[model samples]
Target: MNKPPRKKNPTFGIAIFIVVAVLLVIATLFYNAITEKREFDRQNAPEPTISSDAAAAAATTAKPASGAAQ
Candidate 1:
């Protein structure tokens, strides 16, 4: 039995390597960008506001009810 000669595809291998490297670089850039965005958001996040019910309760406590003595 005679086997066919093997083919050496150097270009294909190099192309694959280049494509993989490019994809890795792109993925790294995207990951870093997302991480930086999250960090920025965490740092600059707004302070939580008091709920309306809590605010109203506080207001009521601080000030006397209507017609109460001053």
Candidate 2:
């Protein structure tokens, strides 16, 4: 039985390697950026200014539906 002739160019393997290498590099950079951003946000996120007392008062004073029968 005769086997099929193989193509000479090794470009398929080289292309696959290059794509994987680029993907790994991009993934590393993206992960690093996301982690840094998350950490920075965690450290710098704003604190709510409303006091607990004011929040409680507002909740208690909130009105019901205006169209509802009393």
CA lDDT of each prediction against the hidden true structure? 0.92, 0.92
Give me the overall lDDT of model 1: 0.92
lDDT of 1 by residue, 1-70 (tens): 9999999989999999999999999999999999999999999998767796688788778667799988
C-alpha lDDT of residue 46 in model 1? 85
lDDT of 2: 0.92
lDDT per residue as tens, model 2, 1-70 = 9999988889989999999999999999999999999999999988867796689889899597999878
Pairs in clash, predicted candidate 2 = none
Estimate candidate 1's RMSD in Å.
Answer: 7.1
| Error in Å for residue 18 of model 1 | 0.3
lDDT of 1 at 30: 100
